[model samples]
Target: MAQITKAGLTFPIMNSGNRHGEVSGEPLPILMRYWRARRNPRDIPALPQTVRRATGLTQQDVAYLAGVSVRWYRQLENGVAADYSADLLDRVATALDLSPAERATLYLRAVGRPPTPYSPLQEDTAECWDQDLLQLFVDNQEPMPSYATDLSWNVVAHNLTLRRWFPWAAHGANLMRWVFLEPEARQHLVNWESDWARPFLGQLRYERAHHPANAALAQLERAILAGSQDARELWHRREVVEHSHGAVRRLRLPYHQGQEVTVRMVTVRPLRTVALCVNLLVECANPGGPSAS
Candidate 1:
């Protein structure tokens, strides 16, 4: 008699004294069976259903909730080897009503354990960061300003050079907030209107449009609109910035006697989470500003 989860399986899951963090077979078969059982809820246990169709989600329902196509979700349930993003998996787990332990197990099976040890007590929405990969970028970009941002444009990870270049980054998280509301930003960023604020404000607007339901982003937008009269006026311009890659901008670095320097922004997305962005600022040798002093 095979069980999806064996009896007496405690936290820090082990397979009958096997090595810690080791998993047997793939994880989706269990989910596939779970989905099947949901269609016939009597097979598992009794549960009240408002609608007569079923108690839990159908494949289409899961696809809708997780923002995937039903065909894709069907393949996933059928144990297809697909490179799904962490965010997508979490969304599916939420739709599946998976416990923290089950979520952790699924993650373990899909991507192996994250750089950080698996924590079964984590919340359903929690994401597992590849700390080593984040650290690798930070370490490799020594003396060069590079940082990673989440969906909210918050500086989730950064290198020493980033902190050195913009001291505000040391404590002032939420890069969007800094760009919009921080006084220090206007001082450091050259041409506070055309060069800095317009582009960033456009990006904020674009993100809000893309993720209208995101409360954090909505709150950030409201705060920016309330805090800066400039933001309000520019936001009405109705511009949208899709991406900033290869975009040249000018700023006053903390060092070099606060000299105006030209930098180009290059953006990359990690495989673990496509929504997260990593930006590396490369300074141009020739400062192309009007007063390239």
Candidate 2:
């Protein structure tokens, strides 16, 4: 019998008669050696055990929650089944209460690739704002850097003050993408780990959970995951947090001449509507200070 060991799991390969059909010859041994040479190890965790441990659920419980028979679920866990359909895997993911990262892992293990990202259904009642309303909002936020973003953090509009400050907060710029993918962001953000990366990613996770099927958001996530190793690591952590308001962040501006500026970030929703629009404002921490620039 031939065997393949990979990722801490061992798979036994069935042996049939040698193709050369020479018993007591070099052909059989050579074929076995060739099979052995093909074996490669991977670093992925064992899927069954990972799901079991993470969800803290029994096999029976998972089967029940997934709306599948216990025997089928057992076969899945034991890796005896040939393959599971994507829909079945999705059901199992829900049953296990998996996070987005965990669900991605499950799909990778079962299908040898991540599941296709879902695109949310478009609603007919999307809110509409006139240019005057938007302009008025921007005009009122003077001296302070302020911008408006849609639910997915796409900067729909911004004041000149914001452009003067970040320069990267251009129309259609995604806040998450800018923070995670832009090299300039790393230089400008003093506390990238705690102040910007964690909270921003946490808020992203929260939004993703709420709008998992948004195609544009999914594409942006894919881009971010591909662009930055730090973003990938933080994303897999699956830390979900509510959006923070009035948070203070330290920044190193190009014009600040080696002085770190402390700015208070304020996040607000212009209308009390889900997935409508949000506004971000940055103000100086110290009143009447040069940092306000």
Candidate 3:
């Protein structure tokens, strides 16, 4: 029997049962390094080569687009495991116009973890809604109390009934901002902190987490945190709700003697326009009494 020292640990070598081999004129009962380990033979390869080549963008171009320094982005491309945040990696993925698979590979290799689900490139919040979509909701004869919002929670399309319920949406407004920052929302929505704002905050947090590179969503979060003290405090709570679909909320109906009504919020997304959310409100319970406010 033979022994070897490696990294301060003694490793026992194979005994005479080992097949005979001689090297450097060593004896036939060869002293084999018993604790030998196999290692990855190939070096870490450069990442984003396919994406960068396909986009025909240099490292500087990508760094400029991703809002990162060229040196940092170059290290990222060289497959260096730096302390890059998910947000920055997301930005790089967007800059390279990486496909979902490419982005997954990039994230897995760089960060040792898969990224959040694929998000389509965030569009400008000011983009016009399709005329058909507007007509189907805002101008349609459908009596249902419905409203539509873009990813930024802007009330892009809404009917008279929804406007009647939420007067601010009558024109156009960011719904989450209204929920979090508006004085009127605080007054009308029952349990503003627990019932209304908390879930909305959770939804906001959820969206922002999944779509780290969405500039519009990021701006919306910043605005919410700046304007609402309660939102700022509650934003750190460990909760994340994707949406409030099918949840019943109590609210004082607009211009209806401030009638307290429980409405079930039904949220639906358009297949063609995946970023649009159409929310329909069904009055589930209407306790006839003076408003809670």
Candidate 4:
């Protein structure tokens, strides 16, 4: 009698009694069939070959787009590089113009783990805002600078007072874009590096992870990275943090001229909606004072 061990179970071999109740001519177990199929020569393609066939991009093009040297990219495609970081793979995926599914496939083939999936929420911009809630937020805040943002951080609504104060919080202006791309933001935000840029980027990273399929968000990310070297470096760091509330900061308000204003920034979420959040910036009593909101 002969025996074989599979999945920690012992089974009789073909020469022995058939444990699977097969009459001598029956097919192998499903697991064995799958194993055999995986060994088929026609089923697998080299990573370099796949990239060539899938994107029709030259090695030099991929290297330049991914911010890697041509020598390194060639080695990676040829499977000679023993180690590659996920960050590098991500850049390669972006350079190749891969879809979410194709990106997952690339990760699986290269690293043996499927990349995180991105299933963007179906909520449209029109459905993201509630006029009643926006009115309530604006009305209740009175003189405070308050505004609402959708999931993509687009300023959906704001009170007249906020516009009077910042003037740049235009309707539909993306917060990330305004902060990174707008020159006025750099001038106004006193602690642009610590208070605004890094924290805001962490929040954007969280959003990108959760909503990877969002085309607009992806485009915005690309634009920011291309426009700012600092932003690109921070993005590659892969640091993630929650959007903070009740943080106080000094701003060189255009309205206030050279003097800085201490303001307490608070973020709030309305009932039954994950898409809308309200941010309130209330003036502090004294310069460099603790948050009052």
Candidate 5:
């Protein structure tokens, strides 16, 4: 864990943790240099004036709410400003009353990073409607279990089939919370040591790095940390997983015989950039043989 300095920036060199057993690192200053040299936060799109009009707030009023000077806020909204900290962006997001998805976008923009762009989620504010749509989609899967989840894994929708397959899904329906909080599910995770914690921990780390002020997300994170040493250790790693695609595992599933269900989770990123993860449970057509890892 030795820290090195270069060009007034600090970085760490660490072990490879692999067969190569090599130590490598990136200089924080260098990454910043590249980011600053090639990046521009001004590229972040401005909040719409119409949205502001709807709020009945003028530019100065909005700036007041955001705790920034009128000129500075104007420059930001005008796309003439560059570089904003997460805290500052959070303040602006609060002023706008942006949804979690919109707030995340603002944070990315403030840091001179472009958000992942995709289509919007279906337009529906009614929770019941969202859940209904989700249920309908997953219900058709039948023996192949699937569930619909919001960005944070709040159980917006799930079929009875999935709920029956994973009883824990019925208990509150928040994926992040349930994964860390459920006693039975916790033990069922084969690698509660790492795999079980890494994905969600990494996802939260990513969210916090940008929207660090989210009280609800922060509270949930602290709660999770309070429960598991593994969660606490993984949180400190500060890694991020986009969860858009690649290998995914269900550590416990009745269909998979409580063995890890190594399934490929497909993600449909709506224009809002919130991930819609679909877990396709592909098991052997024949049943009753020794379960595959």
Candidate 6:
């Protein structure tokens, strides 16, 4: 009688430990059957194209590093074919220079791990110096309610209680976004047709000339055109202004405050990477006040 056990065991007498422990050929057949099923590329998981965009690497580059053909990698990205062996998948992960989160995604897709969410880093990330510089403006209480802003004036951070005065401060959420898109800005602005809009339009043109390949800047330009016809016209004029400094503008607080405030705007280039504007809002000691030097 043949002994009943895993793998092919031909035996007349059942031995407890006949050969050194090793997987028998019987298990190999079953393993091959499961392996064949697992090798289908379409059945396995793969990282999304969005993930690739976030990682900032092209598929061709990733494939070359992974030692796989570019066509095969594209097929993997598209979930077209499955030949992802554990070892091969490991090579691919390393080639992509994946973060821990990204590596985990690939692992799950290859093996039977649960799907997890991965957040990719954006390219136009502001540096720590930018934050520090922005904070300096906020902490200095010259009663001048000072704040710093980025090119789009997203108000990455601000200390001014001016959030109360200029409702635009909130809209300053994204400087370029507010300038070109917001309807309230277009209607309520004192000089939407000329002064205020002109300089910003000029600065934007200068920025375009300097950074034509800058994706964030390009996206902003696109948004402006998409958001408003006026913005489109302003862009076409090609007015270019270097946002260094000049005269100040009087901004009225929203309907609630109704107080007209004189704000001196100064641009400081502490770093070459980011252009910063420090806005110092003037307050009055008397009813009709003179400007603070």
Q: Kindly give the stretch of ten consecutive residues in candidate 3 with the minimal lDDT sum.
A: 32-41
| Candidate 3 lDDT tens digits, 49-129 | 342243234556556656689898766664344566777876766555455665565565555556665223354344445
Output the worst ten-in-a-row residue range by lDDT, candidate 4. Answer: 39-48
Tell me each candidate's TM-score. 0.55, 0.54, 0.54, 0.56, 0.48, 0.49
Clashing residue pairs for model 1? none
Superposition error at 187 for model 3 (Å): 1.3
Candidate 6: minimum summed lDDT over ten consecutive residues — where?
A: 114-123
lDDT of 1 by residue, 52-157 (tens): 5565556765675455798987776655556767666666665554556776666655455532332211222455577677878776988789998877777778
Q: For model 5, what is the alpha-carbon lDDT of residue 240?
A: 91
| Winning model by TM-score | 4
Model 6 residue runs over 4 Å out of place are 1-133, 167-172, 271-273, 282-293
Query: Model 2 clash pairs?
Result: 119-213, 120-213
Which residue pairs in model 5 clash with each other? 118-270, 118-271, 119-270, 119-271, 120-271
Q: Residues 126-240, candidate 5, lDDT per residue (tens digit)?
A: 3223446556777887766676665456665566766776776776567786777566666566555465578778877776665554454554565466444557667777779
Question: Candidate 6 at residue 194, lDDT?
Answer: 73
Model 4 stretches with alpha carbons more than 4 Å out? 1-127, 286-293
C-alpha RMSD of each candidate structure in angstroms: 15.2, 13.2, 20.2, 15.8, 20.3, 16.3
Error of 1 at 213 (Å): 1.1
For residue 159, model 2's alpha carbon misses the true position, in angstroms, by 0.7
* Global lDDT scores for all candidate models: 0.65, 0.61, 0.62, 0.63, 0.53, 0.51
Q: Which of the predicted structures, 1 or 6, would earn the higher TM-score when compared with the native?
A: 1
Please give the TM-score that candidate 5 achieves against the real structure: 0.48
lDDT of 2 at 183: 78
Error of 6 at 131 (Å): 2.3
- Candidate 4: residue pairs that collide: none
lDDT of 4 at 224: 64
Candidate ranking (TM-score, best to worst): 4, 1, 2, 3, 6, 5
Task: Please rank every candidate by lDDT, starting with the best.
Answer: 1, 4, 3, 2, 5, 6
Candidate 3 clashing pairs, residues 3+ apart or interchain: none
